[model samples]
Target chain A: MKRSLLPFFAGTATGLANGLFGAGGGLLAVFLLNRCGIDKKSSHATALALTLPLSLISAIILFCWGTTLPLGALCIAILCGLPGAWLGTILLKKISPALLSRMFGIVMIVSAVRMFLR
Target chain B: MNLIALGIAGFFSGICASMGIGGGFVLMLYLTLLAGTPQKEAQLFNLCFFLPIAAFSLWRHRKNGLLCTSPIKPALLGGIPAALAGSLLAAFLPNAQIAKLFAIFLAIIGIKTVFARRESEQSKEERVIRPTQKQ
Candidate 1:
């Protein structure tokens, strides 16, 4: 029963994190899922999967609240991101989880340090 | 919009999101620091930008059977409303305050990531495969 509820709890935290920060929810989800005994690769994929509906919901709420950017800017951002997303997916399949995990750590640390200092 | 900045932001954000690294923070920082976007607006843009890239990544992951369905329902159950509340909260906070909070959050997660231990590739793959076969 407690085990079953882990996903719900994980989701709640993820939604809050993502909605509040506009990013990092997936990382939180992956961390939580990993603790819940999900494998690293699956945790990563699960985090990605969950981010979809969660982000859509958040986007809808932001839209309803009139908090989003203009249409033109939104379009340009998404279009530009498409190629990166495609390339990322290919890389995801090719990369090993251990290496990805290390990279994720480095990215989080470096970015965090930069943000903190600035 | 600075087309070049937008392009770079979008590209990196897409890659990070697809890889489940939560690239939104990076995009947010880039927009705020480099593109001179207001923090509040940058946060909003990150969410919107995340939508398409995340969707695309989800599709690819699902098609490849990388996604595990077991946690989906419960995660949604908890995540959806919390996200809504978080967005509402973000609206009331000051921009600088939000940035500070974001920085702190990033630092914590970063530390956790750095400390996490990973097994060898072969062992990791076996573990993933073993669990899937059981399910």
Candidate 2:
């Protein structure tokens, strides 16, 4: 694939993943951006920049389609999430992400198995 | 107690999500498995949950000089239409089916995470070598 075309394809995949699953788009974005020769930190930040809009669009679409949102839960999550996001952004520069990434991966695998059994 | 637990989970999920890790997975897993939220509904919650957190994180990243703008335009152009299409497809699919597919996706990401080269180490190495090479 042409180097220039990579971002478009990456966006397509990221959008598809986000829209379909309501999550995971950033992971795809980061991976594709890395493949596009972006450094890890930039890839992560840029992925956020990419996925943020995509998620907004998807959320609106999903809501209009009559997906019942748990507004109370959302409020709680967001309220707590704000500070955490702040901390995460700081940590992004201060800490090495390799260990956390692997830990998160392990947690994801465990969660996946649990979901399968449900 | 439940609320506190949810709050804690939300905090951690926020951290991961902001970092461009798959925080949605954490939130989705919590909602569906622990909170007993329906699968599709959980997805919606995850999506809604991301917006504000991402906005904040992006602002922070921009301030920190970590953001790169080069990829935004093309990606958005391709992403918007694809996102709409994918959401339409999801609307048609059964919740159980989406759940199963999500499980598979999670497992794949997990495997990749476990096995992929340590990104921070690579970046560190790059930072070390770039200036020397430029000399």
Candidate 3:
């Protein structure tokens, strides 16, 4: 396969997963981009960029399908999430790449187990 | 309904966003399993929750020169359709099936994570050894 096409394929797969599961696209993207020869931090950043469009498209689809959530809950969650995300980014900078990768793995495993048990 | 739970979910999701990963899963699971929201609805809510976080994280990453923009266009092109299709499928799928699939997805990611970590460790060891060997 052409190297240039790698992002396309990776995006499609991640998008599909994001659309279906409403999460984990960035996780998958990080892994794929890393394999495609990007550095760990860059992969993470790139994944974030890619995630925006994918989530937007998928969110719109779900919304149009009549998936309605409580307005108040949504408001509270966003309010908290913004700061949380900022904190995470700071932590990302302080942490070593190796440690970050490990954290990523731990999160994946924990998430998998949680989903399994649920 | 629980304000504390909502805050916790958002905070964690934000952290994940900063790491350039999607924390939407955490938000979705929290809402569905703990907060008593329906599965499909929880997913939708989670999506909305992360939009701002993703945008914020991306902007920061770009400003810091961490973001590699080269692959974004192709990714967007390929991802949009897939996302649409996946969304449509999830909308119609039964909750049980979606739950089962979610479990499978998590498990796969977990397994991959383990392997990825190992591979990274091994490569680091190689880089160290190769330099010493050339000395």
Provide fnat values for all models in the order shown: 0.77, 0.80, 0.76
Interface RMSD of each: 1.8, 1.3, 1.8
Clashes of each: 1, 0, 1
lDDT, model 3, position A50:
84
Task: Identify the candidate with maximal lDDT.
Answer: 2
Which has the higher lDDT value, candidate number 1 or candidate number 2?
2
Error of 1 at A101 (Å): 4.5
* All candidates in order of TM-score, best leading: 2, 3, 1
Best by TM-score: 2
TM-score of chain B of each: 0.83, 0.85, 0.84
Write down the TM-score of every candidate: 0.87, 0.92, 0.89
Measured as a fraction from 0 to 1, the native contacts recovered by model 1 come to: 0.77
lDDT by residue (tens digit), candidate 3, A62-112: 898888868898888899988888787676666644455556666766766
What is the per-residue lDDT of model 1 for residues B2-121, given as tens digits with 9 covering 90 to 100?
888888888888887787766776687678777777767887788888877888888898877788898888889888899888877877777777777888888788788777666465
lDDT of 3 by residue, B17-95 (tens): 7686557767776776677777788878887887888888877777778888888898888999999988889999987
Q: Candidate 2 chain A vs. true chain A: TM-score?
A: 0.93
Which ten-residue region of model 3 chain B has the weakest summed lDDT?
B113-122
